[model samples]
Target: MSADSMRVRRSFSRVWPVALLAGPGLAWAQVSPPAGEAAAPAAESSASAGSADEPVASSPSAPYLRTQIGMVLETRPTYLGSPNRETKLRPVLGLQYGRFRLSSSRASLVESSGGGGQLSGASVDLSPRGPWSLNAALRIDHGRGAGDDPLLAGLPEVRQTVRGRVSARYAITPSWSAGASLSTDLLGRKGGTLGALDVGWSTMLTPAWRWTLGGGLGLADATYMRSYHGISPEVAAATSRTAYVPGAGMHGVGVSTGLTWNVSPAWRLGATGAFGRLTGPAVDSPLTQARNNWSVSVGAVWVKDWRD
Candidate 1:
């Protein structure tokens, strides 16, 4: 009721509303966790989500571009002639863009006949997307022998090859698919054409591994010469032989199998084996006949991108 008491009461009344309005906010501020703890779980959850998304990182694109460049050391033991031996150091380059692939390879026979290396080849492959994927490839190769080299001097030759393949796949399960392919090859010669056909089955052993097994028949005409050698002009002129010594128009059967392993998302390793037997008119020719022999090759392949 006194002046001092009334003045104190008036001041308290003015501050009460503001204090009441700030109470809940202040309580919340005090109860909140420290900055580090409050942000810890959020950061952890975000990292987990990122980890979950990684498996799908490679699936976004179609018609990916994959490329491989590597060297292959080959050993050939003389089957028909003298004990011919050669070591080759080769440089190989390959490019794949979308559904198309191109490659070229050159090798120098380190100790062999010609001053110029023996063999070189170039190939192009096309694989387009469709209900059934179709793959086609063409290759050309040449081999030359030095004048002094006894075994290959008469064998200097150029060869062209064409191959076509059609394949279709059906998914049997989430992790398994069954597919079949039909393939054929045509060899061009100065005299005639040689043709071969193949049918094969491919199975996916895992997401990163595959295997193929196949067999086929081959037929060649009189002028059909193998790509590895050229008939000597002197012999051809004297013998008036349009066909190879073994003659032409021969038939043979062959079997082939291959395995591919994906070492990483960007690299692969492959091994292939082939065997053949020759029959028919040309079989009599020492050079034209196919012998029961097996060839095996292993290679490493690399790819740049999997996106279109």
Candidate 2:
């Protein structure tokens, strides 16, 4: 095979597992139709009062204030360990001001700045060219603590870490996009580097409904692998656990699918489901019991268009 073909094959191999996790959800969420076909009613709603034979006028775009709130129920392994599951209720929020956006779901923010450029909680991007754009950012990983779970009673705490990342994305088609990111813990809190690649697509089923699907793979450097998954002799002796050092490798993968329903021009509702699995060192860690995690959520959004 040609070099490009080989690269594509390798990429698919890495992403296949994630796709499998997210694939079935597509069928479950496919209760809609073509995106273009879904917008007719919304356009008609904005028209001025007129006879059927008169041309319907279109409204101009305006600045708006938007916010969302929701509750999520999720099952996850206790402290990244313990086969036992913990059910938790989480509150999620999203807000938008002009070109600025903030999402409690990811604890992040994004805004347009400096003449059409964009800035996000972790990165920045200049004007996008054609179907491609590049961005860079710094991220924080609030490391784990033994006190976070009973299963981690004797394990050492993993402190907060700061990482820098660069990413590039391309529009594969009007409805699909793909991207990859590279990141490294620049502050040495768990000194390591990681990479990921993902693809996503969305479609509108009706004037009120839309859904999206996405999946990705994760890889880590030896330092990152060891920091989060390895047990040193001293730590093993102190904690009474086996000492096992993990090497660099693919750590995990996951997928997600979600749907949104526009209740009106000012109100919307959403639901999402996601699944993930741990592998490599993360799976081999003495602290690890269950390698799989899943979550589901539902929420609503409210918006106020500003005439100013």
Candidate 3:
């Protein structure tokens, strides 16, 4: 192998065993470097007017690390539409080389929502990624567990499974874009699918600071709705709520915002917030303890470009 290839392999070897966004078992939000944080703008080029808020590019074989290693504060429902809320603190980490990225944050391709979520996964572009891009990812969903709450303790378990996603994004302008994503259970776990459409806008407040806003509409299938929302007669008897059968439709809508700062050449800082609400059958389901959801994350990254 060439020296560059050897160096790339060695870099990955060092980080492979140290789980972060790309790590194993721990399904924090998937990411290499926080996907929520757009990289600082590079020199104005021929594509500059069309590709707003895109990350800096490295050679396909070059090794690089883009990570936000700090605590993330997120407040979300204990379960999908559960009324119960839990605030969690997790560390953020991301590793990238070429067009590939590995992250623990589920906040994947759909930018208009809070996060696309699941676990660390590898992503590759299907077409040349630029103002228009098509990408695919394979990740593991740790699945929902039996909860301590009496309301959720009796529901059918959401089993761990492998998931696949295909997403496409089109830049409408330098500061605005639109995208769609679909996720499905590859393991045939009866885990249905989730799909979303979103529009995003970003602007550079200063040479070192940027801000973004986005909105999304979500949809799910009957199996998905039934798995999470439909309560069985036995579960109804145990939870003291009427059993429900849900037909899939509009899942909900969401809005999100983020800020990223180029603190230095080697460091970047970012913060993001999102809000969502359950709609259609989800709101009427007994298992949905809460109809609204929200979360926030903040962190900083130390970057190293092997080619640099």
Best by lDDT: 3
C-alpha local distance difference test of each model = 0.35, 0.48, 0.55
- Model 2 off-target regions past 4 Å? 1-73, 79-81, 95-101, 107-127, 304-307
Model 1 per-residue lDDT tens digits across residues 137-178: 333322222331354444444332343323333333322233
- TM-scores vs. true structure, each candidate: 0.52, 0.67, 0.77
lDDT of 3 by residue, 194-276 (tens): 77667777777998887777766677788777776788788788877798989978777666677767788677677776666
RMSD of each: 27.9, 17.3, 7.7
Shift in Å, residue 32, candidate 3 = 20
TM-score for model 1?
Answer: 0.52
Best by TM-score: 3
lDDT of 1: 0.35
Q: Residue 81: error of model 2 in Å? A: 4.9
